[model samples]
Target: MKGCAFNVIIQLRELFNVEGQTVKIDDTVSAEELSALGGYEQYASDMRLLGKIANRAGVVTLSYAVSVTLRHLCDRCSEEFEREYGYELTHTLVTSLEDDGGEYEEDYILCPENALDLTELALSDLRLSLPTKILCREDCKGLCPECGKNLNEGGCDCGK
Candidate 1:
């Protein structure tokens, strides 16, 4: 919210009226604010969001790609490392839900006021896309069970 680039609000009124209308947004989100959200890893760099909202044949949709670098401690070896991650996300936007029963709530984003908060939407999507398990590498040997030495470096004194 403190950053300038990611705090974008789009008026969906025009997009809904015209078919094949598209609006593109490119911005950077602050790493400090994102890291303060309380996650296992910290964001080392600002997140880059490149996205487009389009009305195709009366269907309005939002599609975006997010990229960022994270600093994490390996779950197995306890080594600190940084890794880059990218996610492609898409969602259908609707002014209102056809039914009040909320059956199709998850299938679409409702913008009843004809406005969309791109910052909040992108942040929510990014948080959901984070990985559960983190490792330095797929084949990490991990620490020695007995002496607590990193097995990836070499064998420990108490062989197992």
Candidate 2:
């Protein structure tokens, strides 16, 4: 459940109005404190949300799908690689005249109009799915301390 005083329901019309209503998620999650894994960094480059609105059980349910880019540092080699953000998780809010539905199913919600913090939600997905160990490349050769060379480039004096 989203820990907030109230969740916002983004108007489907407004979201759809944009070229894709794809907002960046990199600015959503807070990552000041994270574990150091295999000497690399993990982050979300660009996370975006896209979806529509529909009525379910007489309540306005916002349907959404989000995507973003995940940057990881190679665990074996200190290299950086990027993975497209597939934050396709949809969230719903319940804003109604009475009986505020604290829970929902299938990304459904009840809102006053049709508005949501697309930015926040998208960021949330990005934060939740961030890789703990970032890899620059699946088969990165890392740095050669003996000569400071990228092993993936071939020919390292560090002795293969």
Candidate 3:
């Protein structure tokens, strides 16, 4: 899809009277647009659109639960690592954050005042699900501290 460099940002509030029996949002959220976000990395080949837009209750809540296959570089081994990120993402449409926050600790939701940029929403939800530290494995020996060679494959002789 052609992503407009000017209005790559979207406002969800623009979605009004948007009720569908089953609406797939992947079309709405473009991949090229997501790549533009700073430090944005998306691995999932597809986005699973599983949620509802309840314009009836004067609010729209979206639920996300999709598994993504991402190719990551191991911090230690410097090898390509394939990982899957799967989880449920939820958001509620309200007028302001003050309405939700100040009350209780809610997970993550969106406000109605702004247009619900599906692209931003997806990027944010995916970003939060990412791990702080990436490792090839739990017992990974990692690269040699001195020679900087991958120790998992036993191809380096750093101590010699």
Best by TM-score: 1
Candidate 3 accuracy as TM-score? 0.67
Off by over 4 Å in 3: 1-33, 40-48, 55-59, 98-105, 112-114, 155-160
lDDT of 1: 0.81
- Per-residue C-alpha lDDT of model 2 across residues 24-70, encoded as one tens digit per residue: 22222223222111113454543344555544444444556766555
Model 1 lDDT, residue 140, Cα? 93
lDDT minimum window of 10 residues, candidate 1: 1-10
Cα lDDT of model 1 by residue, 1-160, tens digit: 3544445678999998899999997977678756554455588898888989999999998998888888889989999999988888888888878733555856488899889877677767766776677889999999988899898898877954
Ordering by lDDT: 1, 3, 2
lDDT of 2 at 68: 51
Q: Tell me model 3's lDDT, rounded to 2 decimals.
A: 0.58
Tens-place lDDT per residue, model 3, 1-160, is 3444522243455444454322334333333444544454645354444454444444556665655566678776778887776777766655566765556435545455555555556656777777887787877888888888778878676567
TM-score for every candidate vs. truth? 0.78, 0.50, 0.67
